[model samples]
Target: MTAHYKNIVVHLPNWLGDTMLALPFLHGLRSVFPDARITAAGRLWVSDILHHFPPLDAVASISSTSGLINYLRGEKFDLGFLLPNSFRTALAFKLGRVPERAGYALDMRGILLTHPLKLTDAIMRESMVEYYMRLLEPFADISEIPRIMKLYPDEADRAEARRVFLENGWDGSSKLVGVNPFAFQWDTKRWLPERFAEVADRLAERYGVRCVFSSVEKDRPLMEKIKGMCRRPIIDLVGKVPLKILPAFMEHLSLFITNDSGLMHVAAAADIPIVAVFGSTDWQRTAPWSQKATLIRRQQDHEPCMKPTCSRDFRCMNDISVDEVFNAAEKYL
Candidate 1:
């Protein structure tokens, strides 16, 4: 027999980084409704970290017009929480004929959402995760929501990481440092590759820490840039390590330094000290996670960059010198 209120839809954010940041909210939702079925609806490519999470009952990867909408409608969710502010996400529930729908009132999507929360003056905030949490724990007190971001890597994942490292001649004794140089989404988010390389080299030579670089297949060219700039050698695992190994690799690292990207957030969730180089994005709004993280940003110019593209000649990131990054990394050292 079909269950009653047995299915629910959770529309996730498009970005990988934001999804991990919403851990607290996700947990809150799960806590509130243990009986109701929870189905996370979003793209599959962005679910590298989320899939590892045990709390989520299921994730629906829907992107195409026919398949995406059809799958969402077919789920038969009793209620739906549209985390994404896009009209399409809200519209899906309406089309699905779901009994209840709730979301933030944005992009003229208020009418689509049955439970549209009223918006006050747009006050600035810190971090994308916090923004997500606020939207999640609405109606009740916002401050009560705990800002917790954590990742649980199982024995198999850790074992796999160890096996990969062992086959490649790693004994788990070497201090692991993660370096991410590519910011695919925005140019302004990318600090100079040479600058990042310099700091990575310093960390390796001065502290005897092993450097590990993370990048996408296309961003492999940036790895070359970092390799050329650094005096000390680094392990370039851009296309080498499989996706499953990413979490364990990140967990193995003592520190992670990168631009505003998903890998940075993963490192933070793994509880590894992270140093994020911020330019166009606001450090306050999207800094790593907590005080344990060191955020290097240029507040002097382009304070809170809501722009997806840069118009300031990369002034925001350019102002952040190699010295600043190295100094921040040194704190964790």
Candidate 2:
């Protein structure tokens, strides 16, 4: 039997990719408590990601534990779903006096939770989307897990994307391919920039699709390196747009080729086909959650180590040839 809860506050994960993966869990929670008002709360940037999600009545941005507790106290939440396994998260809900706090029993915070779910190695080994959805099991029946995750980008976002496209000389008629070569904060996950350039040049020439390279402003140097290596014309829009417009811009693309990064998940949320390259990290745990996606990982003896940097020759990423990635992109185009 499902317990009756009138109001619920779900604390979201910190990272963009993980937050996107939690869409299924959020949807399932809504299904169980249809009448309940759900508030999705997290860091400012992460909370912004949930802005367009309909199930959430509001999105609260938290700067610190004390601020979060005060915010929760004012909201008078009946239930708290702490998606992040931080001890601080559990403590805030407890201090806020939320009647029931539900989360994984990790970080020695089990005693703080009204309902704590035990997490084992087997569960940790599962895909991240599945792992996040497991948190919903203790409270809701959750008979079916959603395979395709959902995100809602409003008309304004689409309009901004269109404005940027026209300003950049992109005609609405041409098939566009997006190349994302830079991974945020993880150098090990990045494939060779020259290789990415080579593949983009080949795909653009063969298919006649307008190839566009995108990255945050901080990654402009890397994007420039890739652009310098390219033989054919590739639009360099690195650092020009904001995160809110990314999904809508991604919607314009026929396909997205990228490393295992936050943008990969964003592109997946936009329902675009992807050719995601994998290296130090395991695609099984953090691959794009899209049926239209194709993953390119080298089959090495020791790979998917889940490391941020490689100590060895970095064969896992280097071994993957440009031809392999080009072939994958060709299939989608």
Candidate 3:
């Protein structure tokens, strides 16, 4: 018998890319329980990004485990899905007295869950989209998990995007290419900024397109460095655009060149053509889940180092040349 849920609360992942990859799982949950009220609970940025998203009825920003437990108790949710693998989140759900809790058995939290699935090696090898989809197997058919990832950008977001374009002197007809040079905190994942500048310049020279760069406030200096290296002027939107407005802003882009970072997944959600560079991370597991994306990763003789920071001169990223990335971008142009 298929169990029916009335009030469901899902604890979303912390990282942006992981949250985006979980969209297919959210869709499956909605399909199985069309009448149920689904709530998404996560960090503030996660809540902001998911605000007004179709699958969720409410978005809660959690500050602490104790606070989350208190909120969960007040909601009296019948079912809770723990998407994050942290033991702390699982404990919160268990203590909050949710009637049912479902999640993978990793992080030693299996004892806390009402429904715990084992984390097999094969599932570990699967892509992140498929990894999240596994959580729906006991409730829904797993053979055909939805592959399409979507985001809703409101009118305000569109307006902000338009304002930035106009301020940057975009003619509205010329193609705009987005270049993202920084990868969150992972130094090993980022390719050379000078190479990025070269690719941006070449793409503009060849296609007569305009290159626009964006990142968080902390990465502004690096974005400026790349902009300075480019012979042709590039529009720098770093620190000016918010996470909620990125999807709307990305819609104006013809092509996105980025490292294996959150913006790479954002570009995928925007359904834009992408040239994603990967190093130190397994491309098979975290590559952009878009048919329009072309991945450029040097085939390392050894396994992926999978380190947050590299000491060996970052050969994995350095091995990929500027010409390689530009050629990949050409396919989409």
Candidate 4:
């Protein structure tokens, strides 16, 4: 690689928090090769989140397996980081003829790697970034783990968010707390809508804060259900808000109460105080990385079932009551 190494590719994770988790490693990559042009590729839903990441010299879109192959084939990248642990990611770089590629030797992708490092023993016990940083240790010794984070929002984005609040009749004079009850795109992962409504009602009554519900287009009905449960005048801004508006709106939030969803991850990245309610997910493994986040996990072991439908009823999340989350909200309120 020359002084101004032009092309570099990074594969980002699918989930929002995991995508942010890769920021430190992304920063490290930039530190090692300062002038290298960095391009990140991932799912379309992640575009909302990664669009705010400045480390990326540019962002690339890969819709299909062929698209990934074609994009990598087109760009003669000097180096690539396969942050997404998959055989296909490693193979894409190999087929694209990238000279230097570094990633964890996962899913037999080691066969395609120019440099593949083993996962650290502590990685299984620690956060996701530790797993990613381990890949870079062989290239250069990372003595102290860097506290890397990202929140890049344009002025237009902020203006749009303000417009959204105005459209919803929010004057921005009173305290506004966001509620995100829809989790991953799975029925079992969601906490009961009635329970969220109950909690929203309590927050409004106690804190004198208005509740603004947030969710993807598919989750509009879920937010409506919360609005139904609210005794105070609640403003429902679920499906109408655009992705670009999210970061700035989240910045203005007094606090965000949510389930294990992408929106929750976004709030944490924006350095907004968060009261995260955990159900089936493991707080230790996927807890909010921000200093201001307060993770409220039910004291139940063996809960993180990565499956969409659990054989057993979701006792872990179901056991978490409206009262528990309301109690945790007291500190942030």
TM value for model 3: 0.97
RMSD of each: 3.0, 1.5, 1.3, 2.2
lDDT per residue for candidate 2 within 1-333, as digits (tens), equals: 455788899999998888888888888888777888999999876787677788778889899889999999999999999999999899999999998999999999999998898998898778888888887787665556555487887999989888887788687788899998888788788998889999989998899888888877889878777767989887778887777677788888999999998889988888989999998887888988889999988877776677787888988888899999999999998
Looking at model 3, residue 109 earns an lDDT score of 91
For model 2, the superposed segments whose C-alpha errors exceed 4 Å read: 1-3
- TM-scores for all candidates: the values are 0.90, 0.96, 0.97, 0.92
Over 174-256, each residue of candidate 1 has an lDDT whose tens digit, in order, gives 88788888886687778888888888888888899888886778888777767787898777777766655567777788889
After best superposition, candidate 4 residue 301: deviation in angstroms?
A: 4.8
> What ranking emerges by TM-score with the best candidate at the front?
3, 2, 4, 1
Which parts of model 3 have CA positions greater than 4 angstroms off? 1-3
Where does candidate 4 stray beyond 4 Å? 1-6
Residue 287's lDDT within candidate 4 is 73
User: Residues 1-333, candidate 3, lDDT per residue (tens digit)?
Assistant: 344688999999998889988887888888777889999999987677887688889999999899999999999999999999989989999899998899999888999998898999898889999998888777878786566688888888888898988887787788899999889898888999999999999998999999999888999788767777999978888888888888899898999999999889988999999999999999989998898999988877664888888877777888899989999999998
Between candidates 2 and 4, the one scoring higher on lDDT is 2
Query: How high a TM-score does candidate 4 get?
Result: 0.92
lDDT of 1: 0.75
Candidate-wise lDDT, in order? 0.75, 0.86, 0.88, 0.77
